[model samples]
Target chain A: MEGIYHDADLKDSPVSEKKTVVDSPDIAQTSDFSNLPINLQLDSEEKIRLYSQMVRIRRFEERSLRAYQQGHIGGFLHLYIGQEAVAVGSVSVMSEDDHVITAYRDHGHALAVGMDMDECMAELFGKRTGCSKGKGGSMHFFAPDKNFWGGHGIVGGQTPLGLGIAYALKHRKKKGACMCFMGDGATNQGPFYESLNLASLWGLPVVYIIENNGYSMGTAESRHSAGEPLARRGEAFDINWSVHQGHDLYEVRDAINNALVLAKESSSPSVLEIVTYRYRGHSVADPDQTYRSKEEIEEYKQNKDPINLFRDKLISEGVLSDEKANLLDQAAKDEAEASAEFAIASPFPEVSELMDDVYWETDNPDQKVSSGEMFFESSR
Target chain B: MPEITYREALNQALSEEISRDPNVVLMGEEVAQFKGSYKVSEGLLEKFGPDKIIDTPISEAAFSGLAVGAAMMGMRPVVEFMFWSFCYVAFDQIFNNAASIRYMSGGLINVPIVFRGPANGGTNVGATHSHTPENFAANTPGLKVICPSTPADAKGMMKAAIRDNDPVCVMENTILYNLKGEVPEEEDFIIPLGKARTVCQGNDLSIIAHGRSVMVALQVAETLQEKHGVSVEVLDLRSIRPLDLDAILDTVRKTNRVLLVEENKPFCGVDSQIAYLIQEHAFDHLDAPVKRVSAIDVPQAYSKALENFQIPNHDRVLAKAMELL
Candidate 1:
């Protein structure tokens, strides 16, 4: 390519060219996460939110996977299974004022951030009442009222946007931060590096959480990634870097809350890579067995499952009862069913609605870009 | 009205808008400290301070995407690309994020940002620097693609683009930056996008153009009227995305002959759409087939002669108009 479109020159060089801040040589389990700076144990209300949100995301994905099998979701259905603990954990530390953006596997992110389940289900069904009004299907869900930016389809595309939102927060002197979620696969993209560099240079209050789910689609991290661990790449930009155990909810929550504390106190960016794995394929179409062995998947599900680990920890610690937890899970499944019903009952969007909302309704009637301008009738 | 360079007109608009709203910001390579790669942002950094006028590290994708995020959060950011050709690096962010955010969010959110930069071919800046991507922006839905010809239109459109509730890509041409013209001195002056400006009136042929080519249309129209006694009506399409086809149809209906001109390649260029729309809506009004003069299909060459041959000049416009007549 003649222009900046070609990346041929960047082929030889891998992701990073600098060193990370390990402080200590050991990169092991290290310490008891229960003794974090911030209180990791959920309060009564926070406990309900944390537990219900995780269960809600789980049941929603299961129902959506079934819906996809039934030919309801026409396009790529990236189920967010095995990532519920990460979303729930990170979102738990976030306040309503904080802005959130993530990559395509965002069903969990939506539910975790309190998006209306009915709207989300309707969006998957491509109904008018969907969160995106049928303009964006499964891959794109946005709830500005809840401070959720979107489910960006382009990989690593939300990183810069997240950084920009953080810049806006810093500009306005607002006491809020932005959380950008991306997959390990997105680590290879150019914008990711650019965003990290600028976020650190400008000291923007944003935390980048890499849901490093072992694979960037079918390829393993060893094949695609140059570095052993993804979090260490942040050192190139002098960004604070750490790895969080995604399979455990307590660790994920504590780690994210710790990251946010550093972000707020310093007004700088930090990279937190959650070492997780997705149980499902990249999309609904993939068999998922092509890259990884069946035994590995079964082992992760049986032993290192995020929900199971959280449930066991809660049960053993007596923070929650198994029966009460079962009730919560059942309630979530029932809510998912009700929302699915609501989506089916909802009507398809009007054909005319396709033209509306393309541009905002302007104050000046004559100046409206799409309202009464061009081929359409200017109704303003 | 006072005559000023097209560059100063744009500068005045930015200074005015920055003063009008605190949320409005400027960010790009050398835009602040160096006063812009072109002098369009001269004295902006000093007047507005570093907080308002920011300089980036040539990270087009990240900075433009950042602007998109800022705009969504109720801040108006005006991002300047050194050249519009560099916009390709941020294509996903500009088209996917900036343009689609509002519609995809069900009107709940929007990005009120403007990506302004030179998108012309006559600068001899080589194939890499001299891309006319107005058609690219115009092709994408949810983006307001504005290209102005004169200082007045340049100043006016910049103001309107800053106020637009959508992502507006202001495709300025380096060739016209220093070109001086009579600009309105009114503080509240602004020319809304999608409205075409009449350069000169004629009865024989309508030469409709945009960007630097609009000057060619005006010169050709003036030459035809004085030398050959052929009166040509010239129309400057200030904005292309929300194209003012009504103005084009009105001109076609009056003159009964049309000659569309542009610096972009003939294949899928802005004029191609205009020519198609002309025949589609004003088919009966035409006395002859509507002709178009566009840049030759090639990666723009660096040599002066090659660059000149690539862009449509007044002679080419005149010849095309005569053929249409």
Candidate 2:
């Protein structure tokens, strides 16, 4: 297929008129993980678990995408296919007291926080058995029990909420941090900047993870943002910041672990810009062809695919044979398939349950402390 | 009971709630060292210390959203918007995040956050600073809006809002801040939300209002009885969302003539909903068409001469009441 980047097409293309895309700074490359701190270093079982978790997320995203294509899922379907390691690698370092919150593309974080595929998939299907009981849909998945605050839909809206989580942890004297994730596009939102100021001012324990997936929807990072590295904006607010390659799961884990430690130990906030790429469009509704060349997507997939990178690392370390890796991949595919089947079989929410969650008073009528009518009967 | 100003009543409520629940925090710009912009949070910092009474930068979106996030984790934040008109900058945080989070989460999370500050237009503060947003807040399903008309109600409703398990918007008035009324000294004196208070009972006309307009209704009720020889019943809608529909209907059924007065604009205002509710439920009882006296549909003028006429006053209520009679 002819890519979007052609010499003849470049002169007419409006996107080419903008600043030439600069290559990202090269990160220190090391295949060995022996020098990592004792706590940060992963055991063979932990390594396998992280690898399997990433595979599960990739499989779940693929299945969800298929469901969206098949017309089973409605509204936006923001797959976490290319950015699985960012969520999995970071969430692996959280303690029980820590919390996680992210923007619309939240399936990876939801799965990383140990949400079952059945409930997560059911939510995508808008079924009664879903995590939010079909009320939240895809961008609003929540598990307060798992310390996963939400799947907030707004671009940069969750930044303050993430700050609040850190505030609560500090107020309660709990030793944990909050991992607030947003896309490269969310960097320009006013709230994110405001949140950065407060997080630094109050010394709240929050690690803001900017998953720079190259494009903010169709706009490239250079076109969308003024800064070279988006994470450097934190310095203006006196926040510590660093950048890491997202596809290298080990690098991601190490970078996030350092930020989490800064948060938990010093009650300080840090910004981690994970240089990542997304194969799919911003949402499934978006067309990827208009934004970048197919070659750009292919290069990232072939060279820096997170799952393949981690799998190869584990294989080279003699943790598993190729047969064992294939079995794990097959198991993940089967689990994802089973989850989709469960979602298909699950019932949609009843019409009677429409007003149930609007108010806590309405839900618990027996312990209802509030008075007067909440819902207008005439409107119904 | 002790005679106290509306500001003092609000101050007492914050003091009591902060003492009652360790989770309850008072946060906003000028809430700590500088005191509240209206002095509603005066002496709170001295009483509760800096941790409980936090002063934030003039960043409404950040602080309001921070409070909402804290509330989700069971912190019970009482965010004071220096002026409720300033809430527009943080509308996405309050309207979208605070109001809809619980419902969107399927009851998995509760935002026990209170967004309180003066939200009236009679202070010559101009259109930018003066916004009566009870109607706007009430329009959202997940939020509960309260417009307390008296010192007693202010203290009671503020306590109730802090204790409530959902996001509550307490819309107050700067003009009413100095008005004195007898407020109860009880610690747990919470006037339940969605209930109405009939200030004075009569049968000739029903003067339904909320916030400072209720005071205008009371003064109008007196003049109607003295000069026009027409008796009037005043119904104060303390809470806007879980509206006191029973009281409104009862007053309408008893008076037979209804007149709605509010500080909001005429089009799609709080009175619009009340008038519909009366005509819908008690149309048979009403002898005349339900009348409404709201602020003139325009941005609040900064000039003192025109601003007074823009909001509902005693004369406007009386004139509208006479038309109904």
What lDDT score goes with residue A171 in model 1?
Answer: 96
Q: Write the per-residue lDDT of candidate 1 for residues A212-304, one digit (tens) a residue.
A: 989999999999999768989999999999987787777888888877877788898899999887888899788788899988777566556
Q: Model 2 chain A, poorest ten-residue lDDT window?
A: A4-13
All DockQ scores: 0.55, 0.78
Query: Could you give the C-alpha RMSD of every candidate to the true structure, in order shown?
Result: 8.0, 5.5
What is model 2's DockQ versus the real complex?
0.78
Clashing pairs in 2: none
List candidate 2 stretches off by more than 4 Å: A1-34, A38-40, A377-380
Q: In model 2, how large is the Cα lDDT of residue A157?
A: 93
Model 2, span B193-238: residue lDDT tens: 9999999999899888999999899999889889989899998989
Interface RMSD of each: 2.1, 0.8
Off by over 4 Å in 1: A1-31, A362-380
Error of 1 at B63 (Å): 0.3
Residue A96 error for model 1, in Å? 2.8
Best model number under DockQ:
2
Q: RMSD of candidate 1 to the true fold?
A: 8.0
